[model samples]
Target: MPQPVIYTHQLTRKFGDFVAVDAITFEVQPGEIFGFLGANGAGKTTAMRILCGLLSPTSGQANVAGFDVYRQNEEIKKQIGYMSQKFSLYENLTVRENIQFFGGIYGLSRQELKDKTNVLIDRLGLHNEANKLVGALPLGWKQKISFSVAILHRPKIVFLDEPTGGVDPITRRQFWDMIYEAAHDGITVFVTTHYMDEAEYCDRVSIMVDGAIAALDTPAGLKKQFNATNMDEVFLQLARGAKRGD
Candidate 1:
């Protein structure tokens, strides 16, 4: 069997007296779509930042793409792509130019950047809008383009932080299709979403409630364990009993 692509053991983080990530442990396999789910203030952000090497944990260990998050953050950064909720493209830059700038940041050569840009534009069916400013594009197109840019350098894992925050349901479904394609091609995706149905699409999901993972299992398993019919019920079963201020 292959080793896990991401490994975390008792990983923890604290802000003053508050425990933001409370000794959580989990593993992610290569080519897996791992869903990280939680509500506001659930500490999902803290855990993700720690894994992405953007924030240091107060205790425990994590290895992302075989590099230690604590001591080998720079190496980890090179092996991972990140997309946040907001559109990350430069508004003034054209669709093609946004790709060029991000690709260049990854240290791609001029030829490599040009090749990748063309491929991305073609793949996203943005040939007609390739020269248009990103600001002028609609939300769904920008979302697709940003996702394409995130994977341009072929990072082993992509971390998506609420990548479909404000989009309509149809757009979100289309976005998940893009995610499936990326995962099928061997890029492990670590995503967090409030959309329970989206969690259903994951190979496995972990529900975080107030800084701790309350449940970790496949969608069916979780629903079965909770005696629920859907992810929304499963999530609520675990998270609903929590005290508000904790």
Candidate 2:
């Protein structure tokens, strides 16, 4: 088995006596599609920001992509990609232009950028649309392109925060296919989502309630343990006990 690419021990983050993350512990193996699920106000986002080196934990230890989140944050930043639910892309830029722009921000050489852009455009079947403005594309296509740009630098791990938040079923299905392809190519995927059905697609899932992980197991395991019919029911059962948003 590959050593865990992401490891967190007693990871906690607090704000003025309010603990967003409370000593959560977990491991994500190389190439695994690990899901972090929770309701609104859950500490999942805090934990992810720490893992991505965008935020520091008040206390505890975390290593992302084999680099310490505190001391080696810059290194961690270079080795990981991030795609938010908003699908950040310049509306005025063409599909290929947005790809080129973000790739340059990651310091890809001109030649490297060109090579990767061509490969991504072909792989995503965006050949005809590559020159069109991104603002004109459908949400599904924009999402696909957003994901492509995020990984253009070939980061070892990609943090996806609600990547499929509002897409249609067919588009969501297509997005997961891209995720599966990324995992197959040995890129670890760390994702957070509210969609229980999407939880079923993960290799393993950790569901957060309040500020700590209340359940961590495979979809089948969680279902069996909770005697629930599906992830929606399992999540519903756990979420009922949450103490937040009161």
Candidate 3:
């Protein structure tokens, strides 16, 4: 059996009296694409932040790459890459410069950074734009570059928070191809998105509502479980049920 790359036990996070993530538990298998589905304010981002070691869980445990989120945060950080909903690259830097800067931070040697930067530039089809300032790139290209920078270190797990948000449908499809390529290379992808169609691309998905998981399964399984025709219908049915219970 494949081992889980991510594991959480009763993971909970609270802000004063408001519970942002309430005792949720799930595991992401190695090399799998795990989609986290939720409406706005459903705590999907909160849970991801906790898993990425950006936020501490108020209670319970989270382990990424075998490092405990609370006690071994530094190890976890070294083993994982995270791309937030917001673009994180330095707009003032050239595309190549941005790659070098991030590679440097990951402790890649100068020579190694140069080699990897060249490889990434070619792979992402940014060779012509390598010298262009990142600020001048289009939204789709900027998103692609941001994603490239996030994985420069080749971490064991990569967390993407709404990585394809606001892009055109074609761009989003291309972005998912990149994600699949990563997963095929043995990298575990944990993603959060509002797009039901994208959720169908995941190997498995977990839908959060009001700080808890309302459903967890493959997209087909979820559709079957809800007696729905598709992921959109499945999501709608479960989301409505969750709202009614709230």
lDDT of 3 by residue, 96-136 (tens): 99999989998889889989999999998887899999999
Instruction: Candidate 3: list runs displaced more than 4 Å.
Output: 243-246
Judged by lDDT against the true structure, how good is candidate 1? 0.90
Ranked candidates, highest lDDT first: 2, 1, 3
Q: Candidate 1, clashing residue pairs?
A: none
**Which segments of model 2 are wrong by more than 4 Å?**
none
Tens digit of lDDT per residue, candidate 2, span 73-153? 999999999998675789999999999999999999999999999999999999999999999999888988898888889
Residue range 26-90, candidate 1, lDDT tens digits: 99999999999977888998999988889999999999999999899999999999888674789
**Ten residues in a row with the worst lDDT in model 1?**
237-246
On lDDT, who's better, 1 or 3?
1
Q: Which number leads on lDDT?
A: 2
For candidate 1, give the lDDT of residue 40.
Answer: 80
User: What TM-score would you give candidate 2 relative to the actual structure?
Assistant: 0.97
Misplaced by over 4 Å in model 1 are: 244-246
Better of 1 and 2 by lDDT: 2
Roughly what TM-score does model 1 have, to 2 decimal places? 0.97
lDDT at 13, model 1: 98
After TM-score superposition, the amount by which residue 179's alpha carbon in candidate 3 deviates from its true location, in angstroms, is 0.3
